[model samples]
Target chain A: MHKNIESQLLKLIPPQSKVLDLGSGNGEFLEKLSKKNISCHGIEIDTKKIIISLAKGVSVTQKDIDKGLKEFCGLGFDFVVMANSIQCLRRPLEALNNIFEIANECAVTIPNFGYWKIRLKLLNGKMPVSSSLPAKWYETKNIHLCTIKDFEDLCADNNITIKKRVYLDADLNPLKSWFTLNSNFFASEAIYHLEKK
Target chain B: MKIQQNSFEYKESFHLLNGGSIPGFELVYETYGELNPNKNNAVLVCHAFSGSHRAAGVDKETDKPGWWNEFIGPNKAIDTNKYFVVSPNNLGSCYGSTGPATLNPATKKPFGKDFPLLDVYDWVASQNLLRKSLDIQSWEMVLGGSLGGMQALEWSISFPENIKKAGIIAATSLISSQNIALNQVARDIIRKDINFEDGDYLIANKKPRDGLRVARMLGHITYLSESNFKNRFGRKLQDINNKIDSSINFEVENYLRYQGEKFSEYFDANSYILLTKIMDSFNPAGRYNDNLVDALRHCKAKLLILSFDDDWLFPTEYSKELHFAAIMAGINSSFIELSGNNGHDSFLYANEEYVSAISNFLNHA
Candidate 1:
């Protein structure tokens, strides 16, 4: 599933573009990007993850996204990515707004909380847990999970134009008619490319 | 292949009198290669905290190469063939220069903790004396990294008429709170140790080995990026014959331990304390002067500040801040963030791109 998402991301970004990966866990994506000559930078709050990222030679700043992106002004980067980390943010929208202001393009990937499995589990009075989100509610960093449709609507409300959208099933296979039916059932994750209006 | 040692006495040993006097010391310096009649081919190379007047080529005592042999040589960046190079052992340093470790004739003992807090400006004042002693009016370039970069910045600002170009690498305008706090913690560790004996351990034949080791360990963490640590050490375990206690402890622990242990052999604990404190008090911003731009406005040199992408100790943002200040000051300054996985030590590592960028910059300068 991670491999599929990575391949799709690689297709979207140009080779050698400067990229900043927010909440860049272990810098896996930046390492992949660097092989393609992309100048990669990252920010992660976790000290352990930061150590791992630095070991890979990825230029990462240890910072909290809640503080806004002020360090990167005038030093331009082509893309800012928040992968599987949007839900973990205290103020996800505000962070996204700052990302858009600093980057020429922004990409984000989030788990669809309204998937049928989660819905059925909630209906049975049980908190949802799946391969995509394996943590218990107390242990989870996914505080602000949202559905694909809800995310698109939020983007629209924020005046952030969707440049591209890709949907994946539970196994990360491309989902057909993902923009419509997948918000509630078939799709497990949604990847969106956004540009500031 | 013989290197000569040069010496001179300061007009008055501020190391003796009012300990806080600036522009108080006279500098005695040695030069390699010939100085041009106009003296425009001169290159000033500032030393690190513990480094000495010998920067390039070989040292006579240990039959070892100079500290920065990789960067300065016949065909190197600051080519001795084309440029007359001058390296001064900074004031408050131990290398044949006037420092806290030096003997005070009046006190008949080492200055110990009584050494005045030396800043980048103090180092520049000594360099000015050295320049006058050599009969050289100005320098074509002033270059350094780490503590040396601080001196280079001072040369640009304090003696703007002397330097034509300045190259500052892997340095910060102001030491961050984290660094200051870290140094304070290390100092506390040393001070609390019974062996330290209030910095009078010399009489007792005791040294703060444990305290200095802990300080170096803390400092070593900041010197390398997390990325470098993981790549070099990761979760690798130390080799052991006994299987009962076998555990895959991270390799970084052993590496840092080696660094700390080895550092003690070559460095003095009290000097380490003093140097770190100097680094902490290094605020180019000046007292009651919050305006960095105004502070840097006096610089006339074409400045270049380089930061490694992975160097968390003195992160790229610090370099960016300096670059911004230089711009507002109308100084011709360029900031380049080089790609490297080695963190802060990348400047010292065998990085081809890093070397190329610097080589190009110096050639153009």
Candidate 2:
């Protein structure tokens, strides 16, 4: 995830709207939402994270995303945020299906595998391993990693509408005009705001 | 601080929702800490199936600490120093309260099987009497785990204005058929015991020890997780030197036998049946045409639901259902699943994080 993850998400959600944060890590993002008067709930997997969230007076449920969000169906949340979480799931497709069933809109961030730097690394005939993409192929938690084009294809095929998409460089800085022109080939990561079509 | 056992007698006949009435009933209870002048700093503790009014402090005669001593004491999770704690034995319990084991005024004999069945509503009504007797306007928090948790939720639903906050731990608002089926096996075993005599064993100066023992053993199975059992007593045997073909039993068997033996010795079979029946009959949503959102619509208390990851009997899913209803019904609510290996009985165990989580909710929420 980007260093400005909360700041980036904080901009998308309006005050007092009900939001469900998927994979709320350590509850810092939820705390930020609470300050803005947003009625926010979180689904976190780690016990320590849940405890921290509880202490903050934020209602967070401990659940495994890989198990799917069937219980959260019909919750009617305004927005759902999945910052650097979808790729780690065993079945990202099923996760998406359940998420759309619950929330009207979603904010998702993913590391772009089609970045020009990653393409250059592939030319060396080695699986890329850098500060940006640190894990080796064998031990990477990103089992369902995908490029921006692939994700867009998934959304288009599933009747989902991408309202907004932002591309960032390796340093998490938003790409400017020329870089945005070829985002799939140059951007290091991408954030998208999606709605069910 | 030291605690003492007390009794509150309602002289008038206490009527049950089922049209059965008791001429007069007594509730044995205990109080810890001094009630403030305003009486707003009061906390009520509801006990589970076999829990007692002795939820805190040690008994002077036996020198044994109460059941929930880990969570309720001078400076425990439920700090008696800061809040007045009231724990009462429900009416239909064998624990000093008026139940089947008590002599009936009409026949001058134990009520036995004739003792009318009681439910969560009956207990809440009787407890409301006790609350009035104490002159407390509203409880700061009413909380419990398992059957006790069900009673706590009943408080919020039935007396919406009297309880400021309710913490439901390791319990469900409605008992599933799966849970009822589990209780049925135990019920059948107890009813068929030769010495049970149709719950009239007290008149015969005999106890349904075998039947009650088997029931408790079966109950012990659901109160724990398979992982907990495995971790506690895996392949260990009572007599390790004995060959596998011999009559040696595993440590788990020995533990269950010990638990059953103790439970049957002190707990009454008739009370056991009555309490389980109460548990099965607890569905507040039934009155609202099975809509939990409508059932909780009038509740004013902030609700906190806590579940354990390993509590298969009432898992985190059950708590999530409650959370869904609470939110939809427009109530301030929270649901937390504590990570633990202790299963349904995790609330009774003294873990730092678990205790802090609850105390934080009680103090802040």
Candidate 3:
């Protein structure tokens, strides 16, 4: 699930960039970035996740995402990335604002709740269940789930410029050709590289 | 394994930060592993407020290991096998060192309240003198937590050319007002005792046991958080048949009482007051025009700062400030807040992650 997203993130990050990752689970991504000579740190809430991250020699601060990155001052990092965890935040917009304040650039991935399968499920009078979001409604951690369009709108409203965007299917394969194109509602997931406008 | 305690007497008399002077003094310390020929592998580990110079190994009298035995063995985090380790009890501590409890040579009486006031700066200077006496020119690193951590920081600043790295765990550049207030109340408890006799209780051969117990009781409370206290004791009664109106009803009360009693047996009341006052006045930036970032700019050692999530006394926010200041000073630094529910004392516990981080940082040196 992370291999392709990591490649996309690698493309966006410059060499030797200092990075702060939000919700960096297990720290495998940061470890990979460190191999590329990038200084990496993380913020995670779960104790087990933090232990796993620390075991990999990644410095992670244990703090709730809802509390925001009040510890870090403005422009502390070269890049800030929150992969596959933005939807779980109680305040995604505020988190994004904090991310921008701490770093010059950021990347965020969102599971497209507006995918065609979800639309089909809604038409059939049922909630969607896809590989990217498999949990039942009540048990899901995606408290603030949003579509690609909704995320783009949030970025525009918050004066964040979208530098790059990519659409992927359920298996994380890029939607490069014709089977269905030109609409975010048809993709399973979306990744956006953002910067302050 | 057995560890031998050693002492060094500074017969020349020393000066203190508060302009007080001592005619002569002694420092008790311990060493582990062999000092390499080049003398570059020496690492000094400072102790917290209540800690001693015995960083590792078992004591003959108590049949117990040192406070940081897990972190400083042959193959442990600090790795004595690879680095020479030196730990010294601070000047104002009651542990085997010259302090208020020690007799004054001139008057032939205990110094007690007459013991000169010392701060982090004096402690750093004294440690530096110990370093020189041992024929060591510079250290590979200086590591500590809590009050000890403050001294390590001051070491880097006070002796900028002597240390290469510093591992500061659960520490802050300055003590918060809330923490100072807590220390104040502990002092009040100690002073209000009728037996205190203006810090000269030893003359009458009477000890202020009750007052010292109350002070230690509250001081222990500040070391932990409500979350940790509740999670550990959780309204559990000490005795099932005991009434709630009793002096000690809950398990936590029993725990605190036991700890306080044990503390009063080993620690001197005057030493506690002096140490807490030093802690209360700790500010590494005091000499740098009160600008923390500017003060940090003078530090030549690389820094590794760690904090625990549940540490309310020196919370993660304080570590963040230290990190920010280090970054601003353009020093190499890393800050990590560990996940633990044990509050400020989490630094005392040995965890795989915490150990690895320290090992990794020291290895990089």
Candidate 4:
């Protein structure tokens, strides 16, 4: 899953572009990105992750995503990426707007909370639990889980242009032949490439 | 690498921030790695409140490793092999530095209450003199934790062009009212002691050992988080030789008592009061229109600020304030909070993440 995201993110970024990653975790993705000649900086709140990221030669700052990106100057980064982290943010839309102010392009990956399997589990009178989201309801870090269609609507409301959309299955394998109209229910995860309108 | 305790004295009288001046003062320091001919590879490490110049390697007297021995070595985070590391004992300290315990050159008596009150700014001013005397034109980095962190921050602001980078760990830009209250309570305990003869306890041949012990006991509690206390000691009772007395019940109480007593044996009561005052008075935004962001504007070096999640004393909010200020000032800055159960003292512990953060900032950033 990590490798798949890396490859996909690599395709989106231009060589030598300055990138900022929100919720960059231990900076594994940024470290990998640096190998492709990209300069990556990250904002992570976890001390352990920040340390690991720093040790790997990634420039990561300790800052909460909820506070927005006021520390970064406008258009300082060519690209900004938030991987598997938007749902956990207290203000997902606000954070995205802040990132858009600092980067020309952005990418965000989120697990689809409205997948068919999840809908089936809900119909069976059980809270859906899957490998992508292993935590119990109370212990889960994600607070704003959304489906592909729900996210697209949010983008439209915020006047953000969805340049590219990719759907993937449970194992992170891209579903090339997936139906666009029912992607929200069929896809397990979705990655959206975004630009400000 | 081998570490040696070295000393330097300023023959010219140095003026104090509060009032008065030190006629002649000495600063004790330790060095790891050799100074390069160009002197650009030097790094100054300011010590915390009670810490001394012996930051790494074994001390000859105690035969124990330096307080920061784990973090500074050949292959450690702040590798001595690549940079020259200098750790200094602050002036108003009991540890091998000119302090209340030092004898007055004029009267042949311990300076005692006569020692001038020195703040973090004073320490930085004095340190700058030492830097110049050593023929160092600039420093590669100036790093410290807690009160030491305040000194490092002061150095960056006072001598911006002279420092290339700075690491401030578990520190604050301004001491809060609550923090001052806590220190006041500690100072009051020391002053209320019957043996504390107006800071002339040494002349009276009496020491405020009990008062100092109580102060340290309270400080130790503040240094540890609730979770760490519960995990380490909890409500577990100590083995008291089959006695049911109320003297020492919980293992935690015994631990605090032991630490307090051990500390009083080596640490001076007057020095404790003085150092805590300096810590309380630290305000990095003082000269820059009383605005933290404005003060940070003058800082030319790259900055790194670190805080611990469980460090309720300095806390993560303080680090954020400093980080935001650094950014607003347009200084190259980074901030991160390391997860720890040890609370404020987490900076002293051996955490891989903490090590890597410092190493990466120094080597890469």
Winner on DockQ (1 vs 4): 4
Q: Which residue pairs show collisions in model 4?
A: A47-B338, A62-B335, A62-B336
DockQ head-to-head 2 vs 3, winner:
2
Model 4, residue A74: what's the lDDT? 51
Error of 3 at B52 (Å): 1.3
DockQ, per model, reads 0.02, 0.34, 0.17, 0.33
Candidate 2 per-residue C-alpha lDDT over A89-160 given as tens digits, one digit per residue, 9 for 90 to 100: 999878887888888788998889899889899999998887767899998888887899999999999988
The DockQ assigned to candidate 3 is: 0.17
lDDT for B353 (candidate 3) = 80
- Listed per model, the TM-scores of chain A against the true chain A are 0.94, 0.92, 0.94, 0.95
Q: Model 2: what TM-score?
A: 0.83
Q: Give the TM-scores of the predictions, in the order they appear.
A: 0.62, 0.83, 0.79, 0.79
Interface RMSDs of the predictions, in order, are 11.2, 2.4, 4.3, 3.5
The full ranking of all candidates by DockQ, starting with the best, is: 2, 4, 3, 1
Distance (Å) between predicted and true CA of A196, model 3?
Answer: 3.2
Candidates 1 and 4, the one with greater TM-score? 4
Q: Considering only N, C-alpha and C atoms within 3 Å, which residue pairs clash in candidate 2?
A: none
lDDT of 4 by residue, B156-219 (tens): 8888988988899999999789888889999999999899999999999899998999999999
* Local accuracy of candidate 2 as per-residue lDDT tens digits, B196-230: 99889999999999999999999999999999999
